[model samples]
Target: MKIALCVKQVPDTSDIKWTENNTMQREGVESIINPYDIYAIEAALKFKKNYNAEVTVFTMGPLQAVDMLKNIIALGIDRGVVISDRKFAGADTYATGITLSAAIKKELPDFDIILCGQFAIDGDTGQTGPCIANLLNIPQLTFIKDISEYNENSITASRFLDDGIELVKVKCPALLCMLKSDFEPSRALINGIIKAQNSDIKILTFEDLGLNPEDVGLKGSPTYVSKAFRPDIKHSGEKHYCLENNSGAQIIYDKMKEIGVFNG
Candidate 1:
């Protein structure tokens, strides 16, 4: 099976930088792989181990992202493809998805499955994966907690929903957006690290992918951030301290209920 993994190099959330226009400043900021992509990597490695599947990772960023690709490549993936170009800068989720879809069409046309994180930390819109599926015209299952099995004709997965878990069997050539779950990420193997050093990272430019500047980056983006600011830290007006097994807690709850707090 051919598994295509879409990953991203995001600025370390703790030390993020923003531009005057509200877009993230990724050029010089210290960056790391999106934390949620760890789940996607873990899932891809599982497929690789169980089914002997060939795994390839795809990402879009500046030219420096080559280093990020190599870093993940050391995690036992086969190869990496980076979509890098100045024209791709400031791309919103929609344009980003378009670019990635085009890259996948040109690079991994025969891929049987595509895996992505539920959302990227930087964007947090959770729109790119579904957008890619829409553009590619493939079935997509989001909020996926686990992938039990992948057979020739279909793949079994469980979606993590708020109310309950939903299990479904999907046909091949589909996309799965992985949700955060309790699992350790796979470590870098020695042989994998060696392979990464020797592997040649493939680069696809906007023109190389036959994408127009007007259709990508800030230009192609249909939406823009009008304003950006941190919300004020507002705390609740009342504070009550209750000792263990104290009736005061119940009294406070009942009084709040009397006041129709949350209609409880």
Candidate 2:
């Protein structure tokens, strides 16, 4: 089976920084694989283990993102592809999806399944996977908590919903937006690390993908941020004590009245 996992390199949430334009400041921050994408990786690895599948991981980022790709390869992915180009910078979810779809078609046209995280922590939009599916005109199963069965032709998985879980069976060549599962990503081994270090990461550019510059990056993004700022939150410590008696009830009533909790 040929499986493609769409991954992302994101800033560590604990040390997030924003640019003057309200975008993420990624230059000096420590970048790691998107935490949720780890689950997608784990799912792909599970397939490789159980079914002898070949997994290729893809990410769209700058040249610096190669390090993250190497780390993913060290996690036992068969290959890694980084779609890096200056035109891909500042791409919104729409442009990102378009670019990724084009890359996937150009590079791995025969892939059986595509997996991605439910959302990236930085944007928290959860739109890329579905958007890619739309662009590719393929079936999309989202909020997937578990993939129960798979084969060369179809996949059966349990999807998460607000109320309950639903069992879904979809044909092959589908995209899945995965949620974190009970299975954690394994640590890279020494041999795997060495292999990754020696592996040649395929770098794809805009020209290679045949994407027009006007249709990518900030230029293609329809949404714009007007302003970004951290809201000021303040806490006040005020306590009230009530005795266990009628007077206590009266005290509570009075406090409620004082705070306008009671109109009368």
Candidate 3:
């Protein structure tokens, strides 16, 4: 089976900063694989182990993104493809989906399964994966919590919903947007790391993918950030003390009543 996993290099959330243009300040900040993408990688690895599948990971970012690709390759992926070009900068979910769909069509024409995270940490829009599926005109299952069965022909997965889980069976050549669940990510093996270090990464630019300059990046994005600001949050703390007796219980009850937390 040929499986393709889409991943992203996202700014570390712990120390995220915004630029004057209302964009993420990536300079000098740490970058890591989108946490949700790790679960997608894990799912692909599971498929490889169970069915002897070949997995390839794809990302759209700058040259620095090669580092993120190498890390995923170290997790036993067979190859890495980086879609890097200045024209791809400031791409929104729609533009990103178009760019990725073009690349996938060119690179993995016969791919059996495509997997991606339910959403990227930086955007949290959860739109790209489904958008890609729509652009590619393929069946897609989003918010997948578990993949129960798979073969060369089809896949059966457990999808998470607001109320309950739904089991879905889809034909091959489908896309799955995965969510982290009980499965733990595996560490890179020594051999896998060495292999990743030595392997050549494939880089694709906008022109190479036959994309028009106007069809990518900010120009292609229908939405734009009008304003950005952090809301002021206020915090208050209170402490109360009473003797270790019925008075303490009474005091607690009184406080709860005062706060409208208790009526009895």
lDDT value for model 2 = 0.89
lDDT digits (tens) for residues 76-156 of candidate 3: 999999999999999999999989999999899889999999988888999999999999999999999899998658999
TM per prediction: 0.86, 0.87, 0.89
lDDT of 1 by residue, 79-150 (tens): 999999989999999999999999999999998899999988878999999999999999999999899987
- Clash-forming residue pairs, model 1: none
Candidate 1: 10-residue stretch with minimal lDDT: 236-245
Q: Itemize residue pairs with steric clashes in candidate 3.
A: none
Q: Which stretches of candidate 2 lie over 4 Å from their true place?
A: 17-28, 235-264
lDDT of candidates 1 onward, in order: 0.89, 0.89, 0.90
| Worst 10 contiguous positions by lDDT, candidate 3 | 237-246
Report residue 176 deviation for candidate 2 (angstroms): 0.5
Which of the numbered candidates is closest to the native, going by highest TM-score?
3
